[model samples]
Target: MKTYFPYQLKYVGVLFVFIAIVLSCIGNVDEFMRGLLAGRNDFETSILNEEATKVDQTLAYQPYFSEKEKDNYLKISLILSLSGFILYLFSKEKSEDEFYQQLRAKCLTQALLVTWLFTGLIYWIRPTYQLNGFYILQLHLIFFTIIYVYNKKWKFGTE
Candidate 1:
C-alpha cells in the first residue's frame, strides 16, 4: 500500500478549510458589525438602520437565521472541515520516510483513542443534551486537532 498521499491533497484540504471558515463567519461577522455600530454615534444610527434594513431585504429572510438554516450551515461546515482534516492528515509529508510513516500511524491511533474517550464521556454524561449534531462535529474537530498536534510534534521532535 502507498504510505503517502499526494502533496496536492494538502492544498485541497486547505482550500476546503478556508471555504468552511468563510461560510461559518458570514453570519457572525454580519452580526458583530451590526452590534459594534448599532449604538455608536446618533448620526450614524439612521444610516445604519436604513442600510441594515435594505441589506436585510436584499438577503434571504433569515435575519438571525432560522433553525433549519443554521443546521444547514453547520452541516456544510462540518463536512468541509472533516474533509479538509482527513486530506491534511493523509497527505504526503515533505520527507516521506519510515519514521514519518510510523508517526502517522501513531497519531491516527492516538487521535482515534482520544476521540472515542471524549465521545463516550459526552454520551454518558449528557446523553440527551449532548446528542446535538454540533457535539459530534466538535468531536471530529478535536480528533483532527489531536492528529495534527501529534504529527507536528513528532515531525519536528522537541526542538
Candidate 2:
C-alpha cells in the first residue's frame, strides 16, 4: 500500500535516519572499546601515573540522550519520511510537471532554514547538556537544505 507525502521528502528523511544510525553505532562502539580498554588492565593506572587524573574528561564531548529521547527521535524521523513518501505518491502532474518539483523544493528549503535557525540558537546558548540526536537532526536540516538548493536551481524544470 502506497501513501502520499505531498513531496518526495521521504527519501531525504530516510537518508538522514540511515546516516544517523550508522554514525551513532560507530560512536557507541568507539566509546565501549575505550571504556573496555581503560578497565581491562593497568592502562588506567599508567594514565594516572602520567598525572592525567582526568583522562576521560579530555576526550571529545559526547552528546547525551535519554532513552526516551532516542526512541522519540527515531519514531519522528520514520514518520516524517513516511509522510514525504506518501506526498510523492499523491502529487498530481502539471502540464509541465515542474510546479510540483518547485513547490517541494521551496518547502524543503524553508524547513532547512528553520532548522538551521534552531541549530544556530543551540550553538549560541552554550548548552550545558548535549545530545547526539540533536546533532543528527541538525545534520539532516543542512542536508535537506543542500538538496533543495541544488534541485531548485537546476535548469531541467520550469515552474
Error of 1 at 131 (Å): 3.7
Question: How many Å off is the CA of 89 in candidate 2?
Answer: 3.5
Task: Give the Cα lDDT of each candidate.
Answer: 0.67, 0.53
Prediction RMSDs, each to the true structure:
6.8, 13.7
Error of 2 at 7 (Å): 8.7
Q: How does model 2 fare in lDDT?
A: 0.53
Residues 16-122, model 2: lDDT tens digits: 54655654554355456556655743465565766454665554345455556656655665455444433432344333255655655665666677677766788
What TM-score would every model get versus the actual structure? 0.61, 0.30
Please write out the lDDT profile of model 1 over residues 1-159, one tens digit for every residue: 244569789899888878877777763554665565544434454567757655444443325765577667867977787788767777877777777677767666777688778888977898875455655655666576677665677656722
